[model samples]
Target chain A: MRQNRFVEKSIEKLLFVAAAIATISVALITIFVFRSGLPAMSGYGFANFLFGADWSPGNGEYGILALTAGTLAVTFLALLIGIPTGVCCAVFLAEILPKRAAAVFKFAIELLAGIPSVVYGFFGLIVIVPIISEHVLPLWQRVNPDAQTTGLSILAGGFILAVMILPTIVSISENAISSVPQDYREASLAVGANKRETIVRVLIPAAKSGILASIILGMGRAIGETMAVMVLTGNVAMLPKGILDPVATLTGTIAMEMSYAGPTHQEALFGVGIVLFVIILILNLAAQAIARKMGAVGRE
Target chain B: MNRKLGDISFYGIVLILSLATLAILIVIIAYVMRQGLPHISWEFLSQSPEHMGREGGILPIIVGTVFVTLLALAIATPIGVGAAVFFAEYSKEGRVVQVIRTFTEVLAGIPSIIFGLFGFAFFVVFMQMGWSILSGGLSLSLMILPTIIRSTEESLKTVPLSYREGSLSLGATKWETTVKVVLPCCRKGILTGLILGIGRAVGETAVLYLTIGGSIRIPTSLFDPARTMSMHMYMMTAEGISREKSFATAALLIVIILIVNSIANFISNRMKGAQ
Candidate 1:
């Protein structure tokens, strides 16, 4: 009996160690990334490192304003395309589609999530890039004959990012919509609202927090995405003046340069890491808060 | 009359939009298969690449991917299952558990690129693991930890409380009850989680790209640098050489992911049926 008790106690201790690994990893990552990156920030001055527009690693100038803007531009453009399409798809699946059709649509979305980012990047590279450069660029150039554009532009990056984040937004919003009390829909119908009106005015409004949470999560996915954007975007270190212009993102810069970076340059890349980390952290926290509110609303 | 027309059009538009999303997936898969399927042969699968991955096959890359993914799963499953058990059976709904949950969520939210940065700094540099499979596997284990924990915890939650109580009533210790009674019932759910974790680790590119050193050769040791299939494709595309080979690599990757996902679905479905 005593031996069995001893074995049980040991297993409990082991489980504690195992569970602690999660917290330990998070704390360690935060500490290591900041430690490596903070020195460069101090050397360049935090504000200058963040806000300075020029980024010439050759000349030792390191500012991330362009990269930050580029990240936001691609992410926002993606969200612009993704949010409406994803939410609409979610609504269609939850409300309009028959059960059998909804199941098929849901499976396709899951498959989209399962597809590797590298494959998406390849698709963007070979397919989207050529179409944009060969076909789309001519039309755009007609509007402004001097407009410089290529297949690899911010637009290609945004399109791919939108596709990549579609699954996330669709799945979450579908859950939120389906979870709404049946009585809410019945109530709307009882008040003489049509099916469309019940959905647009009543169901969507009720699921707003959950939809918002999905959008934030999608935004987080877009900003942190590296490989697809790295391959699709032209990787120029300047603020993109138009959607067709090639630009560099924070993630693109790090992935492109980090492998061959010098000591100081490596630390600066870590500085980019710190910025990306903090941005994603804020986005995640907001998503969590909104999801919590969504759960609370569902309970009530 | 206008209101009725507007409602009909709205439904039509939404229905078309949803179908378009599905069409995109179909188009991508069809395009990749059409381009890549012709290149797949025994030689392509078994031979090592030549000319910086421009002229030959992807045997080494496939081996590297399998090696690292297996290594990651081997390391992750125990710790992940343990953590899930701790959360489901041991930890109460309190501040400590809440903090742990928050940490896990944050870990999940952090981008793979950030994980690459952390892995490069902490594992490859500080720990001196170098740019090798060990570093890549360890980094990927961290990335998939949250997935495994959440799924396993969920499955553990579904196991009826009566099972645990019955085991204890038979004079079994809590540990014995969990292992002998509870775990057996939830084995399929846990297997599903592990398979999902394998899929995540296999599909990951950014984290492995940064930590795995991007070599094309077969790794003879864990310390040797190597490139997985995804990294092979990324490098090929980045260098703008060997477009056909990149297509083939992407096709193989898609095939592998599909197989993994189908197995996951099958297991989960069987588990559901049992329930």
Candidate 2:
């Protein structure tokens, strides 16, 4: 009986240690990144490292303005397309589609989400990039005539990101829309509103927080997406002159150069990692807040 | 008439957008299948590469993927399950738990590329692990830790309190109940979480690329650097090495992802049905 108590005590201690792993890792990652990265940010002058446009590490210039702009531009473009298409699909699945068809489409969406980002990158590299350069680039070139491009641009990366984030947005938004109280729909219909009117005015308005949460979450995903953006967008560290112009990303640059980069150059890349981390952290907290709000709204 | 037209057009737009999304999925999957499905064979599955993945099977790459993935899961499962068990069974809903939960959320929100950078700096460099399967596995284990914790904890919650109370009434200790009655009830759910973790680790490229040293040869030890199918496919296409072989590898990767995903979906769905 006493030995049984001992067995129980040891297991509890072990579980406590296990639960502490995440807490410990969170501390370790924070320390490691900032410890290695901040010195370089301070070395190059924080403002200069951040706002400088040139990222040619060989020349001792580690400005991340170009990559920051690239990540933002691509994320913005992805959300621009993804939000509308995703919300519409969400609405379609939640309100309009037959339940049987919705289930199949929902399964398909899950599969889309499950497909690895690496394959998404490879697919974009092979199929989407050429389509953009060959089909989309010519129209823009005809309009601008001075454009230099290989179809690898913010447009390319943004398009792939839009596709990559579609499942996330659609699945999440659908849940939000579906969670709107059935009574709202019934009351709206009984009070002379049409089905579309009820959905547009009442359901969507009610589900707005969840949908917004989905968008924020999708934006976080787009910002975090590395392989797909790296493959589709040409790795040119320049502020994109336009959607047609080539751009490099923070994640892409880190993945590409971290291997052969000199020690100083590596620290600057760590600086890049720090900036990306701050942005993602902010977005993540925002998403969590909105998602919490959505839960509260659902309870109401 | 104008309002009717507008409403009809709105519905039309919704249908078109939905179809367009589906079309994109179909196009991507179909394109991969069309390009790569014919190239897979028993020989391609069994033989080692001859020259930079251009003239041989991907047996070594497959082996590397299994090795690194297993090591990562092995490291992560215990820690993750332990954390989850603590969160589920032991901890009160307190400030500490909230802080821990918030940190876990932060970890979840972090980009994998940042994970790769940290892994490169911490595991590969500072820890003197170098770019090996161990480094990659260690790094990847952390990347998947939050995932395993979140999923496993959720499952553990689904085990009813009555079950625990029943075991307690039967003179079982807390640990004994958690290990015997509560865990058995949620083993399927735990398995689902594990499969999802496997899917994430097996498909990961950024962290592995930085930490694994990307050797295509068959790994001889835990310290030996190796490449995953994701990295292999990325390299072949990026370097323009061999299009057909890259396509084959991509097909195989897709196949593996499908299996992993299907297994996860099947388990979760079964759990749901049981509930």
Candidate 3:
């Protein structure tokens, strides 16, 4: 009996140890990044680093204003393109498509999500960039012929990011729509409402929070992406004059410089990471709150 | 009536949009193959990277990525599933388990770049491991552990309660019943989690870029710095190399992940049938 009791105690202890280790991993990382990034923060002070306009690592001045702007620009552009399309795709799958076909489409999107970011970067480089340079850029240039940038602009990067985030938004929004229940759809249809009207007015309004949460999740992915945008964005750390101009992002800045960055340079890069992480953390918290609200009202 | 026509049009739009999703996969595959296949060669697969005029292959990068991911899965699977077992079987009350579960969920939601930053700061710097493979694998193990545990818990929950009752009736202890009956019943689900974890580890790029310093040559040991295939592709593309080699490597990685995923799905389905 004593031996059995000992074994049970050990099992509980083991569980505690495992959970502790997991949490420690995340915590230690946050602390260490802050520690390493301290030197740069001291050197430039927070206001200058955050608000200054130039980012020339060679001459010892490092301002992230343009990089932050570029990051926000690409993220906003991606959300703009991906949200409407993803919602339409989700609604169509949930309300209109045949079951088997919808299953195939969902499977395809999931697989697309599974593909590595490196592969996405490779694909964008070979296929998307050329299409932009050869066809899209010239058309835009016709309006502004003297525009110095030919390709590798924020628009191209934003388009690629939209493609990457599409699957995430579609899947999440599909679940939102599906959770609306058959009874609601049936009641709307029984009241002489056409399928389109029922979907737009009845189904969408019912799951608005979840659909909004899906778009927020897409924003997280867009802001966090590195390799694809890094490859296509031309890495010029200046605020984009227009959507067609070149720019850099926080993720891209860290990735491009982390390897060769000097002590101050490396610390500045870590600061970029900290800023990016905080943004994503806040976004995720908002999404989780929205999701919870959605569930509570959904039950009611 | 106009309403009836509107219903038909809605259905038509849904069909077209749904088919378009599948069309994306077709377009991606077509693009990858068109750009990648012609350049694939045995030498390209076998050789190492080159800087100036030399022709390079992906031998080291492929091996390094596989080795690191396999090592991480080895360490993470037992602990993750063990925690899941404890939560599902042993936890009688509420708040502590709820907190632990929430933490795991938050960990899963944290971006890979954050994981990379954490790995870099803690594993690489605080631990003084100096961008070695072991540090990187440890970081990745933590990153994927949440996914494995959640999926395992879901699968364990699906195992019918009757099996546990039957085992207890036969004079078995809780541990014995879990080990013998419940574990066997949920083997397919557990395997699915492992497979998904593997896919995440194999495809991961951002974390590796920070934790594992990009060195193209083969690592002599786990403590050595290594470059993964994804990292290699990132480096190559960033350097503005011609698209041929980069595309070939990308295609190769995609094919490898597809095969692994399909095989995993097949095994799990077979296990489901056997049970």
Please provide, for model 3 over A1-300, each residue's C-alpha lDDT reduced to its tens digit, 9 standing for 90 to 100.
779878867877787667656566656666777777767866888888888889999988878898999999888898887887788889977876688677666656767777888887777777777887788778878898876665687887898898888887888788899999899999999998867898988999998998888888788889999888887788899978888788999898888888789988888888877778778767776777787788731110
The candidate with the higher TM-score, 1 or 2, is 1
Candidate 2 clashing pairs? none
Measured against the true two-chain complex, the DockQ scores of the candidates, in the order shown, are 0.80, 0.74, 0.56
Collision count for each candidate, in order: 0, 0, 0
Best by TM-score: 1
Q: Residues A212-238, candidate 1: write the lDDT tens digits.
A: 989999999999999999999999999
Residue-by-residue lDDT tens digits, candidate 2, B168-225: 9999899889999998998987898899888899889988888999887899999999
Give per-residue CA lDDT, model 2, range A1-300, as digits (tens).
Answer: 999889888988888888877778878888888888999999999999999998899999999999999989999999999999999999999999998799788877877877777788888888878888789888988889988779888998999899888887898889899989999999999999888889889999999988887888899889988998998889899888899888899899999888889899989988998998888889878877888877731110
**Model 3, DockQ value?**
0.56
Q: After superposition, which runs of candidate 1 have C-alpha atoms over 4 Å from their true positions?
A: A296-300
Relative to the real complex, the DockQ score for model 1 comes to 0.80
Candidate 3: clashing pairs of residues: none
Checking candidate 1 for backbone clashes, the offending pairs are none
Model 3: residues with Cα > 4 Å off, grouped in runs: A296-300, B1-19, B50-56, B264-275
Between candidates 1 and 3, name the one with more favorable TM-score: 1
Question: Residue B218's C-alpha lDDT in candidate 2?
Answer: 91
Candidate with better lDDT, 1 vs 2? 1
Give the candidate number with the greatest lDDT. Answer: 1
Error of 2 at A232 (Å): 1.1
